[model samples]
Target chain A: MTMDLLDDLNRAIIAALQENPSRTNKDIGKKLRVSEPTVATRIRALEDAKVLRVMMQSDMRAMGRPLLALVDINVEGRPPEDVATELAALDACTSVSIPMSNPDIFCNVNAVDGEDLQRFVDDHLSKIEGIVSYEISTALEVVKLDPRFGKLRGE
Target chain B: MRLDEVDREIVALLKEDARISNRETARRLGISDTLVRKRLRRLSESGLAKITAVTDYVAMGHTTTALVRVVSAPKVAREVVEEMAKFEQISFAALTTGRFNIVLLLSARSRREVADIIHKHLRSWSGVHMVETLELVETVKHRLDVALVVRDK
Candidate 1:
């Protein structure tokens, strides 16, 4: 109801969602003693600010998903944008980015099976025009996986 | 979204232990278990966050871990990422600001395996200009900081 009430609630909501993105506002509101409308309003603001996004913590392994792959490419003449576009089109491509360098780009993708790693290499990486070379590394274990761009740590 | 004193308390409790249950959460916050459950559900579904099990990678078979930074041509960079995504050994990748354009998180059984990967996948690549590697020695702490929590007190 009050703007201060809204801000405090919003902070709590951000804290909650950051811990468990799957939580519902009703549950959040019930904990806050406020209407669900209040919870929803503040959530919209956080989302509009591009501070948060919702995604499934999917167990791709259950569906026989392959390892998480990271690839770096060296380009001779081709543009990173074109390479990014092609990579984004891949069935396995989860995310792609072109860094501020001549040809280096980073990508994360899901494979159907571990063997698909090679198919991904032969089919996609090799197909890019001017792809002088590419490096493929499969994740055997993920130690630290985080999405936060810059984490502010303080007392 | 307006949190009250109780809600702040809830955040404090969860920050201490994410595995805390609804009943315990309610008890700590002095709210009904139904309310605690309700709040947790709201927080998770809103994409604010989710409670999931995190494992120590070193406990597994992976004996080595490293970050790879690559420099390449524009055309090659995209292809490099797409192919990298398909690997069975890499779990993380990001484009960052620095001398190197791309960064990768990798795990392998031995130095030989890593060398093999570099030779077969990265070293032989024509587009790749450089690869800088850094091994992860340890993870001190990784998690979110609840804004409402007073840590110094």
Candidate 2:
């Protein structure tokens, strides 16, 4: 379902949770002028529909994986999707995607340290078949990482 | 900022369901509710963890997502990224060390909007030497519930 199908109440509930996911249903209801059960029901529906999810996300920088590497892979013989699937299986890779442009596959990985990153490139990345060549860009600083993508009201 | 065993356990429980009550978590972990509350508070305060809602851009009508690689002039990469980060359409932006100096993830309703963002804003910026848009065709995997597995050194 698209954002247009989602009612205002649903959007408001999502916004409230995005602002602070730890807030209780009762608190959200009070803040949004709705009942606690209403808030809970809306959240359940949203989750059931695969529209949104509330989960704990750890800061990789604070969790020992301070290094972020963006890799663009050029695949030759094999399908880029197959190569991306292999890369996604690795523990360090957070996201893997097939782009519609020059780079066949693009992925962002997190490593524990410089040594760990080198090991990942040498061991995992190098071993993947069909990878003709790849370029790795290390992020110096993550200026912004706001994951809330369903802000319907432009908040 | 190293997470101890107890902290890891708490995070694991919350990873399953961030909305889980402190009392429920405490009962499951066989710890006191006060301790669970304290640990969560500490984690958030220390900027080590966050309990937040992550939405599906596709389901939200943002069907197009692209990774924009920007090659900015030397000494202005950070400034360009900071400015791009302020836009609501761009979800992620950072300065990198490679051929492209800055990388950004843009999500919008359609490819037209993504192109507009690239042409109207990103290209208009003064220091932006070159811009490349890699539209994400399909997301093979996006593990939002990442495991808190800290490798022992």
Candidate 3:
């Protein structure tokens, strides 16, 4: 099997799984119109390539981490990726991104409360070397969280 | 809403593999299959947890991903977000503080496609005052498998 065909099949398999994560390998193969073994091998390949993963996400309110904030950090001396990696190691961080825009690193964190979040900023984030400035934007409400990439363009 | 140790364990296992069988989960937790099923159903019913398949947008032919920061009038921030939410391409939307009133996550086939979406839908909105786009280089880490710790009463 060529790498191009495998990539396409993997994408299709991912799309199918995104629609329904609980489907078994056999069920997924049936839906994708591929042999079961082929599906299994392709899935294993994707998994090995780190292109696919199954994850469970809990509602923040239900889990007691009601305070979700997006932090934009500006680094003066060090590389943004290094700072991002440092920030990513924090337990509160959920997502980290290095964008080609203002504030070098963008991070999303789920904190226990306002005070906890403040302390995390003052103590943890502020102490990171080369971080020139940082801004925290508290989320009033997360209107949408998870998005279906396959159905993104209404296709 | 309080979760017991068993419930947390169940969530952790599901985080590892959403498709793990009840028997396998039961064996790992040293519990009965029936109990595992009941707990899972309760968790789902209570809206505490959900297992879903998600893909990296870049992997799905979406070569470009941008985080748009919209500055809206304080009075119209909520309204602008509502309008933004109507578009299906937006993966994440949040009402926020600081310089931007709302942040939107957009993924598309190319840089041009992202610009088209912004011009066609975003700028047209009356409430939008300023719009800034942050093109993401990479998602260094996205951790969804959070471990739940039971709180004391």
Candidate 4:
């Protein structure tokens, strides 16, 4: 949290985790010339300060399902709180949010398998009272996605 | 990264295969080696991108994956996110604006495990307004599974 805490070793640890949130603290420390305990402590401190979050990175393609659905919903006059409440109830709606200003809501629904996706459309998102229309940009390709947080250090 | 046509193409290639050498990428893009090196430095300096080898969960013997949506009192969202992160397959959680307050991208060894996690863990929490989930039926391209369309000069 302090500027002085942002050392090269810490930055390296952050970078390694940014690439793979599932990596071990030992591995991160090995790369950064710090002890495992030190890495663990720093990571704890970082997490406590709300600086870093971790997640396992899974390759969805290994599953036999087809299509990475990028469902963008265009909304108007819908209270965001109300819309969020309804959208989160659907099965296929994995990630639902408003990323940009133009469109009020954006949902990342992963429909790799199951009838749940269609059911989700019928049950959750469409049922939302304020939703006007939505578009599905089925991922032609997933170009890039990486962790947004990093350790900030002055050059 | 202030990517010109050439740099975007290079990034697209790297996104697909991070192992490509500078010389190889330069030759393939018909750009000089110096230009390739210079551009790569600029991209890194700008904090615009990063490249890393991703993992496949199925290869590791895990079987089921699901995304769980959570809505709760504002005070408890962080608590929920923390609880989700402690799980092995609950890999990604984001606080977003929409119909849902918090969404988690999770994985598990079996369908039953997902059920157990939700029933035993999530279902009991207080201030939790709703719990809805969708199991991943298939995965085509993961987080970085596609190439960004690059314009050619």
Candidate 5:
């Protein structure tokens, strides 16, 4: 796939989807004053190029999995990337990233309750051989979570 | 926001295909198109569910995305967060319990741009004592749902 530059119409369509992903291609074309086929073609191209993806995101708290914690793992005698990949294989691990600074690996995990969390740490997380120490930070509240693909031009 | 069986089915269908037509959703669930539309509208309006376009930062010309951890005095954590929210480069920001008061997900075209955000825009806050930037190598899995598969009844 070629590196296609995001044009104005593409940006407009993305902005519209960001507001309501369920909007039909015809509806978006009408709103943006573009042809329906053009809108459809652009949407397909964006998705194919990995630039745009539409997915359902259910609130974890609403789903009864309220415990969201960010764990910054300090790798002891092994490479951080391997440790991160190992953690990513776990079912409860939602996100795992190998950071190039501060802590070696940063992961976000969710649990249903305190006991579940304890089992996760003792049984799963700590048992990973290379992990020396980890700092667990519970997300108190989200100030902002703008999952937009990029700036929508003119902010 | 309790999701009924129909709601769960709608969610499961949408999770598989966000662009699925309401008529198709209704057909699959053996319900009327209007009910599917109504339920989707209610779910989105209540913030119980969201359908949005998520991009791969690297694929979008953004070479670097960093998780910046900010340490600020407890009294000024809110003030510090308010300042960080104004920058469009920072996508996710939250106050957490740990060594850092706020963690922000920032993406930029290059390392220099990321640096400018941290130095010029972010670190200028008087209340911010220390700012640590962690470059994200790869995201193994990132999703807002607990899991997409609907439980069998």
Candidate 6:
């Protein structure tokens, strides 16, 4: 659906839930001044359209994967898609993307500590054939991480 | 908090369907509803886990999503990132050690807004040395299964 079709009410409902995902349909309706069924229907439609998803997320630090390394890989002999698929299959790899710019592959990897991260690079990443060169950036601190991408207006 | 087997099971169920009722979770796991509720409360209260909504930015009309790597002057990367984090368009920001001192993931309504953020705000920052943006073409994988990454305690 286009941006114009999202309408104010739909955006409001999305914003409310993005702020607090646990909010019930009845509570959302009360806050948005709509009926409970309306809120439910809107949410269902959004979900059906693959526009929104609600799921459980955990803090990486709290979950024991305290180290996050952002890796950029340049591919040569093989398709970047194949390399990305291999990277995504690794247990530590959380996200993998092909970029429009340089650096053929980009991925987010989690490890328990520095040692684990190094071992992963040495054991798993080193085995990938197409990767000509790669850069690993260890995140020192996560300044801000708001997962509510739907709340475009900024809270 | 270290999650035991039961806790992992509960989390796994929630990962599949965050809106599942407590009773349904208990039934599926063959555990008491009260136990499910208590574990969920503990998980949430401890700040370890949460049920939240996420969206496909492109589907939500955010046509531009890019990963920006920023190099900042000595002893100023953290400060620069702190300021960048306040922008509404930036969803993720971090200080790092490597080719770039800072990395950010931002979604914008258009490419112009992305350019505005890079040139107007990031370039204008006193400490920012250089900015390299890699616009995402396709997301091969995006999974948030904490259970997959959780370590044994």
- Candidate 6 CAPRI classification by DockQ: medium
Instruction: Give the lDDT of residue A137 in candidate 1.
Output: 58
Sort by lDDT, best first: what order?
2, 6, 5, 3, 4, 1
Instruction: Name the DockQ score for candidate 6.
Output: 0.51
RMSD (Å) of each candidate, 1 decimal: 16.6, 4.7, 5.1, 16.0, 5.4, 4.5
* Cα misplacement distance, residue B26 of candidate 4 (Å): 1.6
What lDDT does each candidate get? 0.57, 0.81, 0.77, 0.58, 0.77, 0.81
Better of 1 and 4 by lDDT: 4
Q: Candidate 4's residue-wise lDDT over A1-155, tens digit each?
A: 34645566665776687566546778888778779999889876655544444422223432234455656576768676467656656544555554424355656676764465576577766777888887654543332223232221102
Choose the strongest candidate by TM-score.
Answer: 2
Better of 1 and 2 by DockQ: 2
- DockQ for the candidates, in order: 0.04, 0.52, 0.48, 0.03, 0.45, 0.51
For candidate 2, what is the DockQ-based docking class? medium
Q: What's the residue-level lDDT of A101 in candidate 2?
A: 71
A33-84, model 6: which lDDT tens digit per residue? 9999999999888776656677787656655687888988999989999999
- Report the lDDT tens digits of candidate 6 across residue range B43-117: 887776877787767667776779999989978886778788888788778888998889998888988999998
Chain B: TM-scores of all predictions: 0.63, 0.88, 0.84, 0.69, 0.84, 0.86
Tens digits of per-residue lDDT for model 5, A84-138: 8789898788778877766888898788877887889999777998999888887
Predicted structure 6, TM vs. truth:
0.88
User: How well does candidate 3 reproduce the true complex, by DockQ?
Assistant: 0.48
Per-residue CA lDDT of model 3 for A7-42, tens digit only, reads: 667878887887777678899888888999998888
